[model samples]
Target: MIKDEIFFKNREVAAYRLLDVLPIQQMKLEDWIVISSSFGGYSIAKIIADTLDAKLDIMFSDKIVAPSNDECDIAIVTEQEEVLIHEELVKCFDISLDYIYEQSKKNYENNILSLINDFRHGNPLENIKYKNVLIVDEGINTGLTMMACIKTAISLGAKSVSVATPILPSASVQTIESIADDLYYVEKLDHFIGIDFYYDTLEEIEFEDIKKINKGLN
Candidate 1:
């Protein structure tokens, strides 16, 4: 990490900063639905959703880590059973497709399902069909998880899928922009150590706090 290179005080500050750069005036805010990628992201997404007076929801996904290195994510699996693989990374690692699929199934059944049940009360996601969708995360590192959310939203019949994040690595911009209808971000860094590195306090959202947040969402 760069010496003392904190960008914002916390996710709330980041979300507010992001709102400054977002193209809000031109968008039909009423037609939009915001979906957060994780509980941590829901904090920022909720602010954006509330500010825009749009509906808010969360998307659940779990990373499929490399067999050799648990910290290395080879792909991501969404609660809806959608898998987004880093094909080149998998090939370079010589990871078997079978292994990836097997891991994805486990991630969905075990991890993703638990999150869905906890945050969403075991109910289905709010209807987003034909609605413009905005996917938000506090920050993005590899963009794999955000990509999974984008793809999942489209598959659920979203009219268009846009993405927003406070911080994003320069390398991921093109790849993410190619799939998303529009992308909004606060800072684009040449090198991002991790999402947590950019913020002073990007702490995990407690389960109890998450339940409270969910209760107020549409």
Candidate 2:
């Protein structure tokens, strides 16, 4: 939020650069479990999980956008039902805390609950405990969701936590670094546009695709 960061022609350009920071042979695949934030993250996570042939899971997070500015994010709610507040932004924008909490609850009920059952396809989340967990997303604009995911992973007993993504805003990098054991990104910009800005094809991914992708792995 300090300043508008980097811009790319497209997401592929960002992903190509992300290659250097990706966790390849550095960690054992057997000891890793790949989990992703729903919707925006599925494609990136799908590729990573399939390539590594690692067990995959999904976690849902919904952001509370500013009342006036749709592009502005005020906070994030995780599937574990934890809420992360962007204190500075909220204060600067004079967003009501009560409103944030209400939205968080609504998002959890309408989004996260069914996502948990659908993503897991009936399996329990026992594999993440004591494992090197990698949380995937296409990019980090506000960084709130990633932070919540990192914290949730730790609470679930993740021994180490890492993040893999194509892009991250410069403002969010330090915040995410404080929480993630290892943070990886293809590009770090001073600011980022909407998630759709980086892609050519933005599709509404069906939940069934998540089940099919992780099938037989867990």
Candidate 3:
């Protein structure tokens, strides 16, 4: 039922469309630290941060996969290695939290940390304390990463949290609204598909791109 029609001609266009609805003009962008969900999530944050002249950071969070099922995400892991189990799902699927922790610890120690160093240039997370943080992604599929990012920011003493995306499911948007100070989006889709389905040309944002983006912050 979810057929793709070029809504805004990819992430750039989608970012602009979403921005028009956001109360960005009312805010001083310099007061925010725009946090990208990394790679695919960086597209929208780049435009918004550059237009508003805000500092940008990339989050290195990802999901913990269930054994033998790459698409079956059982838990969430943040940049700092905090693990959050999808409790209901874990119970329903008859999986143990211990297994989830093992997978998450492995993911954090192996994959996510390297990405954080490569994307954030080692310890770029220090300056975020007491700042307002905005988490940006092209779309929200499960909303777990955004949740983890929000919790991480709060733990790091971010005064407030906001989330911006071009597309999100209604349930995810509602969840985000409850937790974040603001939730901005252009579309709320049902029968939610992956973020890549919305675009015509989605490219991988490499370490060099992240470095270039971070360099602009200086």
Model 1, poorest ten-residue lDDT window? Answer: 21-30
Query: lDDT of candidate 1?
Result: 0.87
lDDT tens per residue, model 3, 90-197 = 888888878888888888889888876665556746468878888899888888878888888888888888888888888797778887888888888876667777
User: Any runs in candidate 2 off by more than 4 Å, and if so which?
Assistant: 1-20, 65-72, 93-96, 121-126, 200-218
Model 1: what TM-score? 0.93
lDDT accuracy of residue 154 in candidate 1: 91
Clashes of each: 0, 5, 0
Q: Lowest summed-lDDT stretch of 10 residues in model 3? A: 1-10
TM-score of 3: 0.89
lDDT string, candidate 1, 98-164, tens digits: 9999999988888878877877768878788999999999888888999998999999999999999
Model 1 CA lDDT for position 54: 88
What is the C-alpha lDDT profile of model 2 across 73-152, one tens digit per residue? Answer: 89999877788899999999999999999999998888777776676644455468888888988787667788888988
* Model 3 lDDT on a 0 to 1 scale: 0.78
TM-score for every candidate vs. truth? 0.93, 0.79, 0.89
Question: Which stretches of model 3 miss by more than 4 angstroms?
Answer: 1-4, 124-126, 206-209, 212-216
What's model 1's lDDT at 204?
83
For lDDT, candidate 2 versus 3, the one ahead is: 3
